[model samples]
Target: MSDIQDRHDSGGSGAGCGCLAVALLLAVVAVLLGRPFLTDDGDGGAQAAPEESVVATPTSERPRSKKPSGRRPGVVNIFTEQGLRGVRAAGTGIVVDPSGLVLTNNHVIQGATEIEGTDTDDRRTYPAQVLGYQKSGDIALIRLSGASGLKTAKFAEKWEVRLGDVVTAVGNAGGKGGTPSVVTGKVTALDRQITATDQSDGSSERLTGLIETNAPIKPGDSGGPLLNTSGQVIGMNTAASAGFDLEKKGASRGFAIPSAKALEIVRQIQRGEASDTVHIGRTALLGVQVRQPTTPSGGRAGGAYIADLIPGTPAEQAGLRARTTIVALDDEPVDSPGSLTDMLLRHHPGDTVRITWTNAAGERRTTPVTLGDGPPQ
Candidate 1:
């Protein structure tokens, strides 16, 4: 290396030193071999280069060029009643069913001006039909007029949506009528309930089953989408910058209802029944916050364990106590908390439910009782 440098400095007459050419080959070999020995960006004090990230993307098997922008389809611009009045308070919604059932937030269409849906190509505008809506779940169902051959949004399973996953929201943030917009963020939290006042009254309503995220949701972005890394619909954007009591000091703490529950409301609307929204005087509330058990078995180790039961809830009223294990519902054994909730949700609040379980003492116990108010967001 020294000989090459000396020859180059001396400006050797023999068509530039041959040593320089040899040294150049050796230098190229050193770079090729040195890279493997060096630590990656985080471990090493120095980084390869900012553009290296861009360059590396091309070499990836699933190259960046092949990645879809999620701009092809499965997105529609939502027009509300407010739009007629030139109010920019509308939100976005996604088609989840072949029959044109759309899922969005309850507040999005609470006072809709005129319901309209526009596909990626904004040139096509169709009058949307509002089938029904459940304010409690922040879910509503709507369909495009004679929407045949429409692309449906793909739904991501719960296991697929992990915290810290990259997500994006596509909606009309400015609610600029036909044109739609987009926002991107990360999944920051989940299973959150925010007690905050809605539009009008002083009282606050609790939003539940919410997957919290930092998605930049604006006023008109409600009922939009919370798409996973793969751009699959995972949740419906509800509220953001919610001034709730618990997390009052919050910013971009947007909340969304998971796709699992949102699909229920969407199905109701597609059915085209006026009363698709099942209104009940009082629904069953287990009043217990439980986690899904790890295994399925004969004893309490595998079933729903009462995490916290309201003092005078339906379960409590029926002699259901704290620390009690829920082994079976009706006659089927419940293997996990999800099973118990699923079973309980099947029945209305006033509906009768038979809970059979083996107490901590191994004594079999059965309690028959009516359900209470459900957890309505």
Candidate 2:
């Protein structure tokens, strides 16, 4: 997790400066609690980076432990390599079915070209493929190859959760591959809402009806189980407050998506119901990075400006180039990069769509391009 930096006034009286500093210190930054492990080259290739160490120091008198634990039959560590930028990310997942159906956060495997899972039960690594995902709800389902007879996670039957209930969170903290980390705390609130921002692009999404707890859930814990006293999962850990001092007691707080809501989305995905927010299969790629362009007066332009195009992709083969603006897709207006992504999600590989763009010469051009199979967007 990274801090959301805020600019503060430098000039002030000593007492006023002290007050402002205190206010800044108390401000909470909600961040998605997952660790991305690899850096990206300018082109779409991964460059190896040093692994991040776990933050194991306790924040309270009742210390959280990072020691290796016994086999967690249902939990697995997930590793993903993104297709476009070649960045690798790590997170936790829970087995929902014996046939290796895993449930995790959408952001954990988003844009992944390859996925692998290491089951804690047997410490065996297996290849994985995305089944479906609901981007709006931040939920996703994946299947591990050649896996069977695995233990499935136990869900609370009644789905009853209350404030002050003792709970434990288990996950692959710091992207460490082995026995997951364990942290215990109490549920502090329910039906909470938080704005989760992607550190890479600063894009944000609102997560509502969350279960808030005082657990020290750290990076790499996303999609792990938030269990009750009986060890039945009640929620899935998702986000947490960033930049908490390790020595400060009770300074950390975590948020989770309730299991009931997550399961609902999972069932929808299993049924192959593709909605406005749910994508049924692998993403279709236009293969161009886009940004908002600026006019001569320094105002935002109307269309998505092409930043770069991947080699041998649909956009490149169709003669799209950097510095142009994509105005429409299949006659649908593309006002921004997000709009273009949303439109692409509605289509699949082999689906041909007409694209309209404005070149550097100010000439508008239209062409039909067949979409290609790509990683999740």
Candidate 3:
């Protein structure tokens, strides 16, 4: 189990959060029939919330249904295998529509070439495709192809959460991919900011304005639902603290993204809002590993050095190779590895661009290549 044990402040310690990633969180335990499955022990030592308490009317309350159900069958298990990065991840997803729209964490399925989901009520698994995703915010939307009659999860509007409110977390605890593990705990704090590092890949994310809960968010619990007493989803379980307890299981505290904020990002993705930081359809990949050089002061220097590129990818098709340094994209100077990613995100698959780089022989070169739709980043 994961423990994100920290009291937060709104002032925000904003640092080390940026674009570029190495390995996504590997939530998988086995590769069954070429599919990745995450396995874990049940909420090893997490705590739950109190039995019964009056629902406090906080400032964030929404117009709730008169009779809110306490049992959710809309929770779906997300299983992914990232082929390129050799990473396997698992998490939970909430069905939002009868037509099979599902919401999950971007990190849960990052770099995944094959995605699948199984609902709580159905034992049959369904293949899924990426609808959209925002890496900076760590949220994503996927669609289960050819699915119907799926139960949808209800979101608590009006921001009715409080510091002491009881909340339940439901998720596929051990990458078991069937039946979720339910844990309870109080809303220990709100609007907390945390920088969580993926132990599998060393990639880090600085998440802000999160709901801090004493409830345990285990491995394979990413993208699970943090539900209120009414069984309404109030937040999406995203990151758990890995601070001091990096080597200890169930030592870090758990954090979640507010349902309202997550829903807003999903709406934008559904509406095809592609920007420098957001991708509306499938993700685009150049198929190259980049590294940043340091300046004389040991600070990060400009230019992204191409350490390697995937064979047959656009990077290779454009005559780009390893040991090359990217200087600019579409005429924009590439200052860092993250900057190159930022510029590439502004475009979509099939779009053509002129890539400028310095060859290993110390000569500047330029080539035009069309981007390719790869996996979710």
Which window of ten consecutive residues has the lowest lDDT sum in model 3?
27-36
For candidate 1, the C-alpha RMSD (Å) to the true structure equals: 23.9
Relative to the true structure, candidate 1 reaches a TM of 0.50
Pitting candidate 1 against candidate 3, the one with the higher TM-score is 3
Q: What ranges in model 2 sit over 4 Å off? A: 1-72, 198-203, 240-250
Model 2 residue 346 CA deviation (Å) reads 0.6
lDDT of each: 0.51, 0.67, 0.65
Please, what are the lDDT tens digits per residue for candidate 2 over residues 329-373?
889998765567778889888889888999888999998988888
Per TM-score, what order, best first?
2, 3, 1
State TM-scores per candidate.
0.50, 0.78, 0.78
lDDT of 2 at 157: 64
